[model samples]
Target: MKTLIFKTASGYLLPLLVLFSVFILLRGHYLPGGGFVGGLIASIAFVIHSFANGLEETKHLIKMHPGFLMPVGLLLAILAGASPLFIGETFMTGLWFENPVPVIGMVGSALFFDLGVYLVVIGVTLTIIFTISETL
Candidate 1:
């Protein structure tokens, strides 16, 4: 596993996967894709790395426990939902913000919600995968 190919290919592949995952996540709020898809994509990337390396190495690479991810994700989702309350709107009500942001047009509260879902999905998926992989 100390070969150059493993190191080099993983080095290149990880960033590319992250970029693609983010692209899917951002576009998903509006298009067919969304948080679930994006999170799965990101999880796959890490899973690939785990297969290439070892579980302990992958854990070290991630620098965080899988159990910790779920809570953070849940918090994000809750925050996204609660955001509307600050503006005198009902919870989970979609609020639009007409901002001319490049690449990501019309950033809105829905996007925040999507992002929250994205984090939650990634966290849950990774937690499951890693936990099961430990048994295998």
Candidate 2:
């Protein structure tokens, strides 16, 4: 690994993949793609970078352990699902805002739940990959 071509390509690929993942996530509500797919794509980007560069360098680039994301994501999801309860709606009910957000459009609890799923998937995938790589 760490070949010149791979390293060079990965540098460009990382950002592109991340951006595409976000695109997938954002459009998932109406489209086929969703948080799970987006998260997988995002994790693949980092995995490619790790393979091209060293694991240490990839970890450095990430700046924090992936495990930390899990709880935060779970909390966000739980909150999203429970938010409707306070307004006398059922738990996990879809709650939409009056106005759509600029880029994401149609702000709702579903999107937040999807985002939470995205983060959890990314965290779990990265943690497993990193741990396996470290062991090997």
Candidate 3:
């Protein structure tokens, strides 16, 4: 299964998939794609690479344990949701910045929440997949 062509193709596909996933995540607020789908796409990239290059190589490429991302993402999401409380607003309230970012448009708690979801999804998914792969 580890054909040279497959390895090379997977190598190229990993970056492309990750980039596309980010694109999907960023456009999610106004479009169909979002954190969950984006994370799935990104995880699929790593899975494909692992299939071609082996688990160790894929793990090495990622540079860190996927499980670590979970808490960080949770913290981000919680912070985003709780931020409104400081301003005398309800929890999980949507708060928008005065100035919109050039490309992503209006930045807000929702975006941060979505980003948190993105990281959480990626972490959870990769953790599960890698665990299953390891046992096989």
Candidate 4:
């Protein structure tokens, strides 16, 4: 894993990759970008960081196991999708609520889906990192 970190001039690109991944994940519902794309982007960022910094340093950067996050994301996505059913709506139906505190419009299933995507991305990205790091 230490071998994966490659500190060099190219290392600066890591932050940008993470930012882009978030963008992809956020825009998933409105655009083509989604959890899968975002996850790949994030994974690439970390992988690049690992290459630039070294696997050992990269390991320190991660606070938790990325693989475990995958299931959490899946659960969130399922819950989001199924929530409509419990509410007497079709699967994946759109739901919204107005936040009385701020009096803001709150959207439902879309956000839930995004959450699921976020989890999936995190899990997949970690899995990739672990696999590649171990091989190296």
Give all candidate RMSDs, comma-separated: 2.2, 0.8, 1.0, 3.9
lDDT of the candidates, in the order given: 0.81, 0.94, 0.93, 0.75
Best-performing candidate as measured by lDDT = 2
Number of the top TM-score candidate? 2
lDDT of 4 by residue, 80-117 (tens): 88888997899989877665224213555776788788
User: Which regions in candidate 4 have their CA more than 4 angstroms from the true location?
Assistant: 1-11, 98-106
| TM-scores for every predicted model | 0.85, 0.97, 0.95, 0.79
RMSD of 3: 1.0
Which lDDT tens digits does candidate 2 get at residues 76-96?
889999999999999999999
Candidate 2, which segments miss by more than 4 Å at Cα?
A: none
Instruction: For model 3, name the residue pairs that clash.
Output: none
The number of residue pairs in model 3 that clash at the backbone is 0
Sorting all predicted structures by TM-score, with the top scorer first, yields 2, 3, 1, 4
Worst 10 residues of 3 by lDDT: 28-37
> Using alpha carbons, what is the TM-score of model 4?
0.79
